[model samples]
Target: MNWRRLWAVMLKEVRQLRRDRITLAMIIGIPVLQLVLFGYAINLNLRGLDAAIADQAGSAGSRALVMDMLATDVIVPVREARTPQELMALLKRGEISVGIAIPADFERRRIDGRAVAQVLVDGTDTVVQSAALQLAQVPLDTTPSANAGPLRDAGLSAAQRISVVSFYNPERRSAVNIVPGLIGIILTMTMVMFTSVAIVRERERGNMELLIATPLSRSELMVGKVLPYALIGLVQTTLVLLLGIWLFQVPIRGSLLDVYLASILLIVANLTMGLLISTKARSQFQSMQMTFFVFLPSILLSGFMFPFAGMPKIVQWLAELLPLTHFLRLIRGVMLRGAGLFELWPEVLALVVFTVAMMALAILRFRKRLD
Candidate 1:
């Protein structure tokens, strides 16, 4: 209600933030570094995947097919085996992702127009399995599918055309999905952790009483305190996204407007949560430890590393309560899926609710203590 008092408190908070250069650098520098590292290291499309071959026929046709696979850049032949049993043993030992078995009658069958080859692939890892399947389907010089009748005339049979699309991460690349989620994690962790320090430092310096003597209400005071941190969170998001685009070539598929709106909502809510924690915390160290506990689940339960579907029922239920989980889904849906508001309304709604709820709680806690 008091505009002048709110602006005065806002200016004070901004001045204090400006004085803290180390915290500023941490918020701005780290996100960019993470973006560059993750962008280069994470690949959904596997390349030069290690594999083995079992060539029972040792015929010229089979050898040429093997060479063709190697040339495709998907599979790199690591070892050769004389029998299927040896190839199987190697696969079980984790030595290879794909195993090509050329039948003993491969050349004879090709001459007789009855050629067939077996491709053994390790399906334990989804990304590697997808890559292996594609590598195996490479046709050898022996196929004359153009002349083959009806079922086989299409060059690929029903089974061969089986479409495998990696959802959430269609390219099956970790970085594409991961970098977006990391933005939310970094924003949540840094904003919450540091904003707690803002209030805790005031308490430590015995400045809370002095600041409370001013005309600012609890809501105005909290807004002023959190606004500078919110700006920092915005800067951090920008640095990370720019690095991802320039260094990693990560596409920004959705409109920048949607991403911008979602980010503001999420950041404000996280900073509010931080303010609430500071109200309860007696020391900076306690605030940090509590932030850590909150961050761990936010990272794990948010489906950052593992698939949500693969997690147990309880874990899945827990994930639903986390803001980071919804934010991650929204970020990925926007960045990778090019999803608009219509497609992302559920996630958008969750973020809006979370921001409002957390900010309200922080305000009530601050006001309750004041009385």
Candidate 2:
């Protein structure tokens, strides 16, 4: 390297970068997106968790107990339950994050200096369980019973006898929670990456003309490109499932069919998303970069690495748009909680819509003619 020649080459490369607007946009966009997700969206200090109120006490003191928990900002009362059975139903359906069951002897227990309420928490996410534990220690200032007013450590350990029960994950094993979500993250990464560059690789390898010459319709061609990888995705799913069971002891509580059904839906959806990116990308490198754009949110906001209930409402809304978010819920519900597809129908429905939308978009964006 001569100094003058090196300077000239550096400037030439800078000009080339300036002209490739997609690369330039990615350079700026990726960091900004990461900052927003990590700084604003990813929150571990969870609050406002969905809670069901089963006020069997139906007394002023019991109402005060509920009010005190609400004041802590640890949980949001989403529905009223007249009985503990109904609250259990909601938890089984994955409808609420926590359930508060106030017994008929709530006031009497408070008067006798006992844990007055039973708090049932969805323990799939540890952060939320920690929040529930924190909530259990909350002091009720307006209790009608003077005896209850002095106690703060309700049922768990000492005074505030808030019997906090962590359902579905009584042992609080990290592997139990992580193994199920890991499957979704793996499928998302591999399936999207496999097909994100499919069309672009075909174009780069000089096979675009052959594809164009074929009599296969665009829909047929798109589906064909994805079907093989979809099978690979299923195989990956099975491998992860087996390894998790053997090594981590993560059990599949629900029907194995439900797990595969949800995985298939997610696999197809992610593959189509990749195909969509491939249709838009001019080269394989660009396609891979775009795949990262889709992957980042899936990892951060899809309840894989952080608590979904902890994120702000707007960030939660954004997370809802990612297919990985729905799949995580579906898989975890089936495996950890023994929930069926009927119970997780909303997530199943969202995935179906996502798969259809991505497939349609990929087909429409695909062109037979090379520009």
Off by over 4 Å in 1: 1-161, 165-171, 367-371
Residue pairs with colliding backbones in model 1 are: 44-172, 44-173
* CA lDDT of each prediction against the hidden true structure: 0.69, 0.88
For residues 1-371, could you state the per-residue lDDT of candidate 1 as single tens digits? 99999999999988876776544555675576456424543345666766787888886667887787788787778887888787766554445656777778766555444434666665434455566667546764544445533333335432343222233344455567567877898998998898777677787888888887888888888889889888899899999899888877777878888777778877987888888888776678767766865786677667676544344456567778788888876776677656665566777788788878877887787642332
Model 2, TM vs. native:
0.95
Per-residue alpha-carbon lDDT of model 2 for 253-303, expressed as tens digits?
Answer: 899999999999999999999999999999888888888889988999999
TM-scores, one per candidate: 0.58, 0.95
**How far is 335's C-alpha from truth in model 1 (Å)?**
1.0
